[model samples]
Target: MASFTTPDGVTLAYDDIAPAGEAERTVLLLHGFASNRSEGWRRTGWYGAFERRRMRVIGLDQRGHGESAKLYDPADYTREKLAGDALALMDHLGVRRCDLFGYSMGTRTALQAAILAPDRFSNLILGGVGGRLLEPSTDRGSIMADAMLAEDPATITHPFLRSFRQFADEQGEDRRALAAFVQAQNPPLDEAAMAALPMPVLVVAGQRDEGAGDPEDLARVFPLGKGVSLPGCDHFSAIPHGLTKATVFDFLDGLLDDPFEGRF
Candidate 1:
């Protein structure tokens, strides 16, 4: 575990998982909304995969979440600020370029970072990147209602939610704070804005993604982009599936060469 200070003076936390030798390249893993670095990748077994593959892993706890500062400024949670934290993490580590993998809310941050820095990332692998955040669709909340209602809402939302709630219960990070963060948050970009990103991109979606349009809508936008579906899975379950795992690894493997040069 390592801690770095952002330009904003927030002491952000990151977990560095690497093999003994020099790192081939770093993959920045960003977690979803209300999730922290450890819960993001550590719990998912993805971090273990990266460690076995000999790749350096930089897992971040986004502002206002996890062990990082929990500011309620709302501005603190914007895509711009989230992406900035990524770059700041890299800068602090002295890494010139690396790949990025963001899931759910983390995916939006990945896209935003690639657009803003353009050159800072070699390739982008976006899992559960549904589409533009600004586009309104009723699908997201409705699909999960049945499942959420059936199960304890927090546990179904994420495995660590129960533990997090317990931590927040003792530490005083209220459920209202989490709810307010979600309500105040909106997708930061539209399709046109996303299309302008020049980096090689991969958009993965769940077959039953309720919040965004179907995978076809997301795939149609980026002809150069590869789209794959996780059969029988929704937004949260998609990434851990066999199909998504194969697709993501294959895509990242292909981008390991010079195309990763700081082009955008």
Candidate 2:
């Protein structure tokens, strides 16, 4: 793993694995909220799958997560700030363009990045995201933030919200940093801007993932978008599932057969 200081002075940790091929295809990975690059992508079979495909893979541990610098200020985690860091990493690595993959919180960052600079991206893959991206995220952030900072995990009665606290505890994440991030205010998603993007996008979600809503709805918003649903999976299970990896691989290889291909 290597570290670089962003223009804003936050240090981020990342891994760059290059494939032994002429094409030198590149893909950038952004992990979910409480996850690091190793746990979110490497241990989840993503690294091996991309290696087998001979694609150059770059994964970043976003600010306040993994080995990256932790900041207790909510303002430090705004959508624009996270997006700036992502773009900065690309520039720091001298990567003009690459395929991008992100999940959950990562999805939000990826979306803002693509919107900010569509020309620097080829294909955009959003996992564990759906129509919820179109809604206001302020409430969601506050709810998760409260759950993360709760004095006792047992007090978080909502099963879905409680899961985050439990996962953070299990991962030994910095609760104060995670709490600030979970409650950070990100600019509401701009669907109009998203629809104008020229790159082909794949929105993938689990069939049982209620938090994501319908991937097809989000997919339709993009001019060149497609949605795929993985059976027998939920939000967390969707990311590391074999089916999820296969679907992502198929889409990346241009072998995907979307269920709602032309409807969009």
Candidate 3:
């Protein structure tokens, strides 16, 4: 449990879990929307997995979530700002390079981070998001923002978006801050932009994940990318699955004979 105040006065929270000796490999974890570092990774079994593997873990609570400062203004949640926080945290911790892992909203931020600081990441593992990253940004952010700001959750008409409100409630997160994060516009990027990333990327999503599109489509864009699907899982359920762990570890360990093949 540690904290750092951003240049803008936003206090972000984070935890650096590492081996007793100096760390050889580091993984920076970015959680999905409405999820804090602990719930997204530690309690979800990632911390233990990394511990056993002897990899250092840097888990950050991005602005508007967890113990971090909550700002109500949408202007404060730009993609660059979100990505900057990740970079800034790394700078704060004196981490030169790491394997980056992000989920859902965190994946969007990860893309921004990779684009901005292409050399800081050695490998990227994006979960809970897929081909949807290539799609144009639409009004869904506004709709989701409205859902988070809704006085009554029942009024949110979109079924899937409504579930976000419910999940936020369960997590006891700040709806106003989350609404701002949802409303913040992402940078203009497409498949060509994704194609430009040079690091090894693994895009993993649940087979039944309707929230994200085809993971294979997303993976094929990168020169060194691969995609894998966790059978019979959805966006949230895939997080703690054994298959998810295997796919990620195998990729990180370079154990797969054909790295380009999109499955285990």
Q: What is the Cα-based TM-score of model 1?
A: 0.77
Let me know the TM-score candidate 2 reaches against the reference structure. 0.95
Clashing pairs in 1: 133-187, 139-210, 139-211, 140-210, 140-211
Model 2: residues >4 Å from true position, as ranges?
21-23, 258-264
State the local distance difference test value for candidate 2. 0.89
| Candidate 2 pairs with clashing backbones | none
**At residue 167, what lDDT does model 1 achieve?**
44
Encode model 2's per-residue lDDT on 1-264: one tens digit a residue.
699999999999999888776545889999998888988999898988888888888999999998899999999999889989999999999999999999988988999999999999999999998887787655777788889889989999999989888888877888889989987765668889999999989999999999898998899999989888877799999999988887787787788876435534
Put down candidate 1 lDDT per residue, 172-244, tens digits, no spaces: 4434435434444555366776676666777777777665445445655653566665567776677566566
TM-score of each: 0.77, 0.95, 0.94
Reference-based lDDT, each prediction: 0.68, 0.89, 0.88
- Report the lDDT of model 3 for residue 91: 94
Q: In model 1, what lDDT does residue 127 have?
A: 76
